[model samples]
Target: MIIRPALATELPALRTLETAAGAPFHDVGMASVAEDEPPALPVLAASLRAGRLLVAYEEGGPDGGLAGYLMWEPVDGATHIEQVSVAPAYAHRRIGQALIDRAGADGGDRPLTLTTFREVPWNAPYYARLGFRPLTDAELTPGLRAIRAHEAELGLDRWPRLCMRREAAG
Candidate 1:
């Protein structure tokens, strides 16, 4: 698999992957947006314009289609992982981790931070295995205010999202 910067044309695929990833949280209304179109297009376009989106690909058996993607933004003193998803058929292949590792490598001069639900598997403990530590909301800096606003607009108010951080290797 290869991880690289996402192109504007890949927005649809990235949105598809994101919607699939949100399935696990569907009962909580996580993927509540209309399926008629991928919302990531506008966000991805804006982020790419700002130079912050990344996509991952692997040669599908005989087909050359995109495999997965991750979107993030660099704010304040950290890189915030906006979303990471692989096609439903491509789950369990470590594509998510590969994209995350790539992000860590590219996050220059800042720590990598992300917010995930407090539930099992998607929470701080899971990321701890990858070297992230949970941080209190009080610890958030002014740089992350915009991110917090976006998350709020998404209606992710249920479980307290644990803010995890890891120093970037790059």
Candidate 2:
């Protein structure tokens, strides 16, 4: 898989890949999550414009189709990972990990942070395996707190979730 900044023309493909990636949530008893729409085109376009949207493409696979994607932004001195999704067909292939690692490299000295479902096997647990640790309430930065608040307002708090952080690779 090749990981690189997303092209403007490929934004729609990332949406499709994200929807496919979300399908597994249904089997995990979170149909609402599975059915949630991918980020809107304008939101994705903004990320792309910021150079924070990265896509993983399967080399030589059907016009080099997208296999996964990750979007992030700077928040409170950290690189806040907003989303990372790999198509089920590409699961366990390390595409998500590679994307995250790339983001860490790009983030330089900043720590990597994200909010995820605490119970989902591929959420907090998966991130733990990747070196992320759950943050205590006292550890939450103002920006992270706001992000969590927004998530709660969106009804994502129906399932347990928490913020996690991984120290910078540097």
Candidate 3:
């Protein structure tokens, strides 16, 4: 797989890809999540414009299409993982991990932080396997606290959630 910055023209396709990626949630009793729309076009465009988005394209196999995408934002002292998704057909092939690895590389030596579903196999558990650890409430920075508040306002707190952090690679 080859990973590179997302192009402006690729934003719409990324949203479509993200919707396809959300489909698996329906099978896991989280159809609401699957139904949620991808972030608005302007939000995606802004992230792309800020050079905060990256996409992984297949280097081999049919057509070498987009495998997945990841986004991050500098929040507090860390690079906050805003989103990461792999189209179902391309999942389980470490595309998500590769996107994350790219983010880590571009993160400027700051820890990577994110919030995720606490019980979902592909959410918090997947991240834990990648070296993230659940952060205690006491460890939540002001930016993270605001992030959680925003999530709560969005009703994402309906399900169990947790903040997690991965240290900068040595």
- Candidate 2 lDDT, 1-170, residue by residue in tens: 78999999998888988888898899989999999999999999999999999988887665365788999999999999999999877789898999999999988899999999999999999999999999999999999999999999989999999999999987
Of 1 and 2, the candidate ranking higher by TM-score: 2
Model 1 misplacement above 4 A: 27-38, 61-65
Give the per-residue lDDT of model 3 (tens digit) for 134-167: 9999999999999999999998998999999999
lDDT of 1 at 152: 71
As a TM-score, model 2 comes out at 0.97
Q: What is the lDDT of every predicted structure here?
A: 0.71, 0.93, 0.92
Prediction 3 global C-alpha lDDT: 0.92
- Considering summed lDDT, which 10 consecutive residues are worst modelled in model 1? 31-40
Residue pairs clashing in model 2 are none
Q: Model 2: which ten-residue window has the lowest total lDDT?
A: 58-67
Which structure is stronger by lDDT: 1 or 2?
2
Candidate maximizing lDDT: 2
Clashing pairs in 3: none
Shift in Å, residue 158, candidate 2: 0.5
